[model samples]
Target: MDLQLTGRRAVVTGGSRGIGYAVGRALAAEGAAVALVARNARHVEEQAARLSSETGARVIGVAADTGDDASVAALAEAAVRGLGGVDILVNNAARTNPGSIPDDDLEAEINVKVRGYLRCVRAFAPAMVERGWGRVINIGGLAARQSGSVTGSIRNVAVAAMTKNLADELGPSGVNVTVVHPGATRTETMLDVAGRRAAASGTSREEAERRMAASVSIGRLVEPEEVASVVAFLASPLSVAINGDAVIAGGGTKGPIYY
Candidate 1:
């Protein structure tokens, strides 16, 4: 299906690696000019160049810390200068969990995922409203549905709420806002995690990955590219009917009837 993304310009935060990178790649391959944003300047730039070469899309890299207002403003400026203007914004930068104390991590995680997403929207969405076309896809996590990490659930739920609010506010102006929830997906980071788990448990890497996917009904971790495919659809003009919704791209959690 034609996603109608040609000539579209997109900004994807946390785009250097993992699901963010996959999203950027998918959009670019679908004919959108893309700006890949991340905190690390050199790394994101290198990845952007590689993506451009691979897909032959006009892709560039911009560096910014989403948690900081000035940095996000700078990112918006850079994206405008690089990609002309962003028609799609993907908010994917966030603090990883399972390490810090849930109580202590709440504020920090919210700062990055919740507030950071708002900053990007504030900096970029007005222009989208002006142009009368835009897509904002916030990358949330499944913790909002299932509960294990307090910080994860709170921050992700906040993103979902934010998506609904933004969608209502911008829907009339031709902008769509949505949130995506991904479960234990397979990305480069997950490969590292699986290797570590294998080393720690004296098991094969494949075995570690199987253990990781045991809770998923598909019996496998969702690939980053698979999640990217969902976001790419949401980022396109064809996704108008899906605004303000939470699309779960995790390989289906085992026993949750989320209807």
Candidate 2:
């Protein structure tokens, strides 16, 4: 249960809330020094302070838009400076808006999800290479396996491909790269989504949530902490067995046979 992660330094992007926040909490709970990254300076810093106070762990917050290269570079620099070094990088920053092939928002989606992830990995992986040990856990989605939203499918699949390629590139240096795909995670944002669904379905929020939960095999939505726990494990030394793999953390993902 130690995870051998005590004192390990980690940087988690999009760490202000949702799965990102949960990931930071999980990592800190495991005794890792964590620096959380988000686009909102005030919110991220507040969450950082709260986490530090609660866990008594070294935690700092940085605000950087992952869609920008220069910002991500600065993020890497600041994170390394704050944590003394980066042993783990969690690529969790993303835009959750639903897109369509006809909508043709592919370029923008690629920028935020695919290119942004690559940017973070590029910025931090070298340090891992230099230190000869690192962990990169890319937050992907189950849409990679499903076929409905082209934007989601492309972005998630792209992240998975990038993770595999990075694992090949960094595996010799003792850096393990992996991707986690979570579906319909239960986070604060989910409440907002549920509220909208309630309005559209002419149902109560509770009923909307229940309908959503019924779609999952577990009869409920997956919690952010559940996904974060998987991510935390993947970010640890104990995850050496799972390099370049996609671990789905969405309440068992209902009846899909994925090899």
Candidate 3:
């Protein structure tokens, strides 16, 4: 199916690696001009170059701290200058689960995932609204649906709430806002995590990964590229009917039924 993404301009935060990188690659492969944003200048640049070379798309890297307001403002300007004008915004830069973190850590996590997402939207969505077309795909986690990490659940749920509100506000202007929930996704980072789990449990990496995949009905962890395909669709004009929705890109969760 043609996603109709060619010539679109996109900015993907946390685009240096993992799911963000995969999303950037997918969009680029589909013929979009992309700007990859992350906190690390070098990593984003390297990845951007690699992606451009691989996909033959115009891809640039911009470094910015999403947790800071000034940084996000600067990111907005830079992305506009780099991509000409942003048509798609992928909010994916966020802190991972910090198990047993102190209560004070809650503010920090919320700032990064929740507030950070808002900041980016505030900075970029106006242009989309003016153009009467845009896509905002917020990368949340399955923790919002299932309870495990308190911080994870709170932040992701907050993101889902923000997505709905933004969708309502922007839908009339042709901007679709949505959240994507990825569960136990397999990426380079996940491979390292699985290896560490294997070492800690005296098991092979494959065994550890299998155990991690047990909860997924697919009987395997969802790959980053798999999630990217879903995001690519959401980032395209073809996804107009899915605004303000939470699309679970995770290999179906085993038990609960979500309407």
Cα RMSD to the true fold for all candidates:
1.3, 1.5, 1.3
Candidate 2 local distance difference test against the native: 0.90
Model 3 RMSD, rounded to 1 decimal: 1.3
Give per-residue CA lDDT, model 3, range 128-178, as digits (tens): 999999999999988899875677788889999999999999999999999
Q: What would the per-residue lDDT of candidate 1 be over residues 114-167, giving only the tens digit for each residue?
A: 999999999999999999999999999888987777777898899999999999
Model 1 lDDT-worst window of ten: 95-104
Residue 172 deviation, candidate 2, in Å? 1.5
TM-scores for all candidates: the values are: 0.97, 0.96, 0.97
Please give the lDDT score at residue 233 for candidate 2: 89
Clashing pairs in 3: none
Give me candidate 2's TM-score against the actual structure.
0.96
Clashing pairs in 2: none
Error of 1 at 11 (Å): 0.1
